[model samples]
Target: MKRFLSGTVPRFTLTFFCLWLASLKLIAQENARKVIRNIEIERHDVFTDLNRKPRFIYSWANQLHIVTRENVIRQELLFKSGDEYDAEILEESERKLRSLSYFGEVTVVVKTEGEAFVDVLVTTQDQWSTIVAYVFEGGGGRTTFGGGIEEFNFLGLGKRIFSEITHEVSEGTQIQLRYTDPQLFSSRWTARGNFITGPFLKDYSVRIIRPFYALDTKWAYGFTGFARDQTRRFFANSREFDRFREEKEEFQVFGARAFGSRFHKRRVQLGYRFSTKDITAVPDRMVVPLPDDEVSHALILTATFENLSFVEETQIDKFVRVEDLALGNITQVSLGRTGIPFPNGVKRFELRVIRSEAHQIFDRQYLFLTLGVQTLFEKNTIASFRLRYYNKFARRQTLGINIEFDYADSLEDSQLLLGGDSGLRGYPARAFTGDKRLLLNVEDRIFSSVNILTVQLGGVLFFDAGNVWSEETSINLNDLNYSAGFGLRLGYVKSPDSRVGRIDFGWALNGGGFGIVVGVDQIFSVN
Candidate 1:
C-alpha cells in the first residue's frame, strides 16, 4: 500500500486534479455566458463589434490545461466584478498576463450585461515554459558554449529556478544557479539568491525586496548580502592583456517610501552599505599602479520618479507580438558618501543619475532615449547616452537606427570598452580602448516563416561604425571603423515574453570579417 501511494497515487492525484479544473472551467464559462446573455441591458458602443455582421458580440472563454492556481490570475486583475467596464483596463490586464511569460496568448472580451454593466471573460493559452536550452557559438576568433535549464513558474507560484554551465575556449568554465520569488508568502516581498563557481571566479548573493506596489506598502525595504572572488584580464595603456584578481565582500540594507499609486509612484530611499575589496595586480603590463586593498562604508540616498504606460495594440503596425509597447519616462538620482566617521571625518562623495524615455514619433515609428551620469565629487565623471529610433512596419520588415556615446574623465581597470562583442561588429576582441567612445548602428530586420522544429529563423542587414579615443587624441572622421554584415537568427518562442534560445550569425562587408554569437535576445556580436 505504501509503495502504491508513493508511485501510482501521486500520478493519479495529479490527473484527477487536472480533470477537476477542466470541469470547473467548463461549468463556470457556460454559466457565465448564460448570465451575460439573459441580462437586460442597453446597447453599448464599446461592446459592439463592427467587424462582425451582427454587430452584437457574445463573450466566452477558452482555458488551456495547466497547473496554475486560479487565484494567481485573480490577483493580477486590475478590475473585478460589479466594477464599471473599461476597455483600457481589460487590455492592460491582458498585456500583464502575457508579460508573465507563462502564457502564449491572452484574450479578453466584453459583452453588455445591463444598461451600465458589462461582462468580461478572459482566456489564456499556456506556454511550455519549463526550458532546457543549449547554446553553441563560434567563428569570431573565439568559441563559447553552455546550457541552462529553468522553470520560470515553479509550482505555478510565479517563482523561478535556473541553473547554467558555460565554457569559453580561451577562458574557462563557469557554473551558476539562481532562484527568485517575485512575491513570497503571497505577499509583496520579493527574494532572490544566486551563486556562481569557476576555476578563477566565484560569486554568491542573497537579496530581499519589498516593493511599493500596494497602497499600504509605502515603507519599502531591501537587504542584500554578497561576496565575490574573481580574476579579470585588462589592457594597459591600450596595450595587450594583463591579469588582475579581486575579492569583494559586501552587505547592504535600504528602505523607501512611495508617494502615490502604483501606476504613478515616486519614491525616496536611503541605504547603508559596507564593503571590502582585495586586489592583486600584475606589475609587467601596468600603465598605472592599482588601488591598494581598502574597506568602505557608505550611506546612500536616492529619489526616483516613474511614469510609464503601455499600449496593447497599434494600428497599421503588425509587428506587435507578445509584449506591450512602453511609453513614458523613468528617472532616478542618487547621492553617496564614504567617510571615516559619520559625525566628522570625511573621504569622498559620489553622485549618479539615470533616465530612460520612450515616445511614439509617428504612426509606426518610435523613439527611445537613455542617459546616465556618474561622478566622484571632484576626481572624475562619466556620462553616456543611447538614442534609438525604430519602426515596426510588419512582421518581416522592421527598421532601426541606434546611436551610443560615452565620455569619461578617467579610466579604471574594470571599465567600459568600445570594441569586442559590444559594438563595432567586425573589430577583434578588445581591439580598442580609450576614455571616450561612440558607435552608430543601422539595421533592417527581415523575418521568415520557416520553422524547423521549434526554431524560427530570421535574417538582418546591418551597418556599424564606432571609435574610441583618449584625452590626448582628437576625434577624427577617418578614425571611425566601418563594418557591414548579414545575420541569421534562430529563436525559440516557447513563451510569449521570454527569450529562451537566441543565436545570431553576422558577416562583415568589404571582407572585414564574420562572427556568430548567442545571447538572451539575439547574439552578442563577438567579431
Candidate 2:
C-alpha cells in the first residue's frame, strides 16, 4: 500500500508541473504577438504642395488655415500604444477622422518595427476651414440671397461657429448664430446651440449629449431644449392664402444602453419629454381656423438595431473626396405615452418606426431603401418611403434614380407639396399641396477628371416627374407632371463641407414654362 501511494503522488506532481509549463508557454506566445509601440501623427495643411496653378492663392490659403492640433487628432483615435494591433479598429479610427469636417483626407497605416512591436502612422490633411461666402438661390421666379461667415475648425480645436444674415421673399430678413463643440472640454460630451431671429420668426435650441460614439460604446445620454415662435403661411398654387402665428416649446432628456457585439449592436433608450404648441390666426390676413393646440408630458421608449459596416468610396457624393458609405441595416422603434391629458381631456399615445437598408448590388452599383411611419393612436398617421439607386456603369459616369412617396391621414396644419422648391424644378414653388405626394427623379451623371484652381467639375442630366393628391381629389395616373433639365456641379475641394454648387434649368412638359433652380448639394440624397 505504501509503494502504490508513493507512485501515485509522483505521477500527480509530474502532471501538474507539465500543465503549468504549458500554460506559461501559451502566455509567452500571447505576449510575443505584435503590439502597438508608438503612434505617429502627420498633419498636412490645406495645400500640401504649392506647385500647382494658382500657387499664390493656395499659399495664402494655407497660411491662413491653422493646422489641427496633434492632441486633438490623437483624442479621436480608438487605439494607443501597448494595445494589440487590430486592422478593423484602425479602419474605424480612419472613418472617425474622415467624419470630421476639418479633414479633407485621412489615412491610417501600420508598420512593423520588430517581431513583437508595431508603429502606427496616422495622416490627415486639413481643409480650408474658414469660409466667408454668399448664398444665392433662384427658382420658379423666386430668389433668396444670404451671406455667412463660418469657422468650421475654430482655432484648430474642432469647434464650429457660424453667423449668417439672409432675406427671403416669404420670411423677410433673418439673422442666425450657431456654435458647436464635438468634444466639449476635450471629453466625449458634445454641445450645440443655435439662435435665429427674423421679422417673422424667433427660434432657439440647445443640446448636450454624450452619444454612442463607437460601436462598442456601452451607454449614452443627452438632453435638449427648443423654443420657437414663427409665422406660418398656408400656400395654394404657389401663393399664400392664409397665415398664422405658432409658438412651440419642447424639452427632453434621454439615456440609452447598448448590447451585443461590435458588428451588430442593439440599443434601448428611455426618455421623458415635455412639449407645448399653440397656434393663433393672424388678425389682418385671410383667416384660417387654427389647428388644435397640444400640450404633453410623456414617457418615451425606443429600441434600435444597427449593423456596423461601411464602404469607402469616391465620387459618389463628393467629387474626389473619400466618403464612407454605411452599407448595412438600421431599424428603430419608438413608443410614447402621455401621462398628463391635453386641455381637451384626451391622452396621447404615439408610435414611430424607421428602417433603412443599404446594399452593394454589384461592383459599382448600390441600392438604398428607407421607410418611416409615425402614428398618433386613433388620431392621425404619416408614412414615408424612399428608394435610391446608383450605378457606376462607366469609369467616369454614374446613373442615379430616386423615388419618394409620402402619405398622411387626417393631417392638421401641415401640407405636403411638390414643385420647383422640392424636386419638380419646373413649376412655381409649392405649386401643388395635398395629403399625398409621389416624386421620381432619374439622372445621368458625368464626372470630369479636371481640377481648375482646386475645384472639381461634374454635370448631370435629369428627368423629374411628380404629382400630389388633395384629400378631395381622386388619384389619377394621367395627371403626372414631368420636367427635364441639366445641371452643372462645382465641387469646392478645399471647402470644409462636401456640398456641391448646382445650377439647373428645367422645362415643364405640361406648358408651365421654364424655370431655373440654383442650390447647394444634390437635389436628391439618400440621407
Candidate 3:
C-alpha cells in the first residue's frame, strides 16, 4: 500500500504515514469525547431520553407454528415485516388472539428477519384436559341424590371442536350430551347439544345454530325440537309439600323452540324466543281445567331486552378488556343455563314487569314504572305492573332498591329460574315449595388482586321472605318461612394469559346449617 502511494523514493509512503497518523489521532479524540459524555451522563431521572431508557429497541419477530393433533406442522402466520421493534403493534395483535379465552398462555418474541425488519412468534398454551365433578342433594320432594362426572376437549383435531357428556342418577336418572363447533360448517354456526333428562320421566331435545340471520352479531341462532312424556302427581296435604305421586293418565308433548340474542359494546339483548307445543294423550279421568277438551298444547313466547352503560365516560374491564380510562364500579353477567317447560296449572297466571331508565338518577333519585295485562285469552294468562327506584348510596354504583307487585290469579308453579345456583344457601334447591315466592339479595362487593389472581370477596346479606297459601291473605303462618344469610364469596376472572377465575361462596343461615356451593360460570341454580 505504501509502494502505490510513493511518487519517488517512498515519497507517497511518507505522505500515507502522515495521513494515517492524523486520522488515528482524530479517532482517539472522538473516543475520548464519548468517554467524557458517558461519565457526565449519570442516570438520575432528570433527563429521561438518555437515562435508563430502552436500549436498541431489541427488535423482535412474530411466529406462529400451528400443527395437527398428531403434532404435524400445517401452516405458519406472519405479519407485514419480519423483525421490527413495534411493540405496540405486536402487543395489540397478540391481545386480539388472546381475547379468545381458549388458550392457557401466549407469548410474543421478535426476531430479526433482515437488517431492519423483525417477525413475531406466538407460543400457545396447553391442549385438551379431562375434568370431573360430583353433586349431591337431599330435600323434601325427593331423596337419594348422587353425583356426576364430565370431560371435554377445547382443541379438537387442530380446530375448535368440543364435546361434553354428563349423567346423574338420583330420585330419577338423567343424561346430557353436547357437541360444539366454534366454526360451524363454514361460518360461525355454533352447534348445540341434545339433552335427555326429566324430573318424573324422560325427554329428548336437539338444537342447532341457524345461519342466514341479520346483524353483525348474527353469529348464530338456535333452533331446537324437543319431546317429553310425563305425568304429574298430587300431594294432597300442603300446597308447599310436593309428594312424588304418579299421575293417573299418561301425558305427552312435542314442541319446537327458537332463540336469538344480540350483544354490542355495552348493550346485551336476550333478543327473542318463540316456542310451540302440541299436546296429546291426556287421560279422561285427570283433574285438568280443560278436562273435556283433552288439553291441547299451548304456544309460549319469551323475550328479554337489556342495555348497560357507564355513568362515567370510561371503559370497564372487569375480567377481560381493561383500559386505563374505564371505571368498573359494578360487574355483572347473565345468561340462560337451561330452559324448562311452563309450570303445571299455569295458563292464566303470567308475571310481567318492565323497567325504563331506572339506572340514571337526577336530584338524588330515579324511578321507573311497569304494567301487566291479565287474561289475554283464558284464565291461564294474567299480567301485572311494577315500579323501581334507585339512589346514590356510596360509590358510583347506585343502590338498586325496586318494588314489584305481580297480580295474578295464581302463582303456583314448579318452574325454576336461570341463575338459581348462586341464590339462598343452606337450603336444598327447589326447597321453597309454595304458591308465592319473594326473594331479595343485596350485595356490596370490593375487589383486590391476591397472589396475581383477582380476588373478589364480597359481603352479601340476603333475605328470603315468602308465604305459602291457597289464596291471598289466606297465607298460613305455619307454612310461612323466612331465611336470612350472609355470604363470603371468591370470584375468578376470565383472562387470556391465565385460567378463567372461579367463584365459590359459602352462606350461613341464622337458623340453618351452612351451605357450600362451587360451580362454574353461572351465579346460582336455586328455584
Candidate 4:
C-alpha cells in the first residue's frame, strides 16, 4: 500500500495522505461494519473492538442470548447457558437494547435447544417497588404538597403499574395510575395504559404509546404512537363544585424516526410526526371552555445531520450537527412530550442543539454558510461545540454557546456523575426548568443492597434550585432565585436499565424531612 501510494501521488502529498489515513482510517476501521455471521465472539474475544463499539463490547461481555419472536429480537440479555450459543446472540441483542433506556437487564436464554432449532428463553429482571414520592408548586399565591404509592411489577407478569395521590392546602387531591408492557407484540413495539385525575389537568387521561424499531443494511428507523382521552373539569373553576359538569376529548398521534451512523465518520439523525384529533363525534357543549376538543390539530417534523471525526493519534473528538431544519433558528421550543400540544418541540430543539454542537457559520464571498468541522480537541474529549455569529459581514456579534457532553468519552471523574442518581438528580428525570432561570441539583448517593438480590437501598442528599419567572419580572442571572435542601431516594429497581423498571421512590426535603415524589420509566438521569 505504501509503495502504490508513493508512486501514484506527489511525494509530499503521499506522505500527508498516509499519515492522515493512518491516524484517521486506522481508528475508523476499528468500528467498521461486518456481515453479522462474521467475526464471532467467544468469552475471550468479547472485548475486541473490531466491528463493534466499546460499549457493545462491555455489554456483550455480559451477554447471554438473543430473544426473538417471528425473526424479530424482543430484548437483549446478559446471561448465558451451556446449551445455547449465548455469546453470539447476546452481542446482536445489545445492539438493539442500547438505543432504549427503559430496561435494567435484558437476557435471552435457550429454553429448549436441539441442533439449529433453538427455543429462546426471554427473562427480564423484575421491578417491584414501594415508593413515597412528592412534588410542590406555587408561584401566584398557591402552593401544594403531595405524595403517593408507586410500584413497578404489579403481578410478576413483567407488567408495570404506579399509583399516586397528592394534595395542596386549597387546590385538591391528585391521583394517577399507570401500566406498561415493554414488548406489546413481542418485538418492535411498546404500549402504556395511563390514568390521571388532578386539580390541574383535572381529568382522567388514558393513552397508549408504541414505538417500533428496525434496521436495514445501512440505516435504522423507529416509529412511535400516542393516543389520549381527557375528561371535563380537567381544570378548576373557582365557583363550581356542586353541579360541575364533565367533558371528554380524544386524540391520536404518530411519529417516525430514522438514524444512520457509518464506521466512525458521521451520524445522521432525522424524523417526522403528525397528530390530529377525531373529535367529530363529541358534542360541542360537552367541551369545556378550553379542552383538547377546542384545540387545533397540528403536525410536527424535524431532521438533523451530524458528522464525527476521531483523531486517535491525538485522541480528540470533533463532531457537529444541525437539528430541526423545518424551522430554522427556532431556539425556544420543547416537544419531547407525547401530548404537549406543540409542533416540532423536542425535535426542533434537537436539530438546533445539534447544529450548535457540530457546526459553525463561515463566510467567504459575502455568502454565509454553516460548515460542520470535525477535528481533534484537547485531551481526546468527544466534544460538539458550536460558535455562531449572525452577520455575514461582521465578525463581532452575539455568540451562541451549545455544547453536549458524553461520558463514554471520559477518561476519569466523568463517570462520577454518569451512574445512578447523580447529575441532574435535582428532580429525577431532569425536570427542573425556567425562563431566564437557574437549575441545579446536588446529590451525594450511597447505595447498599440486601445481599444483591432480595432488596436494594439508596440514600441521597439533594439540593433542588430553580424558579419560573413571568415576562413582567426583570431577568437577572446573578440574582437567580433557588431552593436548596437534601432528600432520600429509594428504588425498587429489579430489572434496572436492561431489565424492566417498576417503581421509583423519591422523597426530598421541601423545607421539611421528606417530600414524597414519583418518577416514571427506569432511566432516571440528568446529564
Instruction: Say which candidate scores most in TM-score.
Output: 2
Query: Would you give me the overall lDDT of model 3?
Result: 0.35
True lDDT of residue 475, candidate 4: 45
Q: What digit string (tens of lDDT, one per residue) describes model 1 on residues 421-521?
A: 67667656555677788898887766567766345676677888887887788888678877777766555544434343434455555346666655555
For every candidate structure, what is the RMSD over all alpha carbons to the true structure, in angstroms?
17.1, 5.6, 17.2, 16.7
* Regions of model 2 farther than 4 Å from truth: 1-34, 284-288, 340-346
Listed per model in order, the count of residue pairs whose N, CA or C atoms clash below 3 Å is 0, 0, 40, 29
lDDT (0 to 1) per candidate: 0.67, 0.88, 0.35, 0.34
Off by over 4 Å in 3: 1-130, 136-153, 156-170, 198-201, 211-222, 231-376, 382-422, 427-431, 446-448, 451-463, 474-481, 492-527
Q: Of the candidates numbered 2 and 3, which has the greater TM-score value?
A: 2
| TM-score of every prediction relative to native | 0.78, 0.92, 0.47, 0.42
Q: 437-527 in candidate 3: lDDT tens per residue?
A: 3444433322333423233433334443333233344534455334445444343332222222333343334345444444443231110
Candidate 4 structure quality by residue, lDDT tens digits, 158-272: 3456777778666578787777766665543566766777664444444344432322223334444444443322212122211123343444454444345432222233334
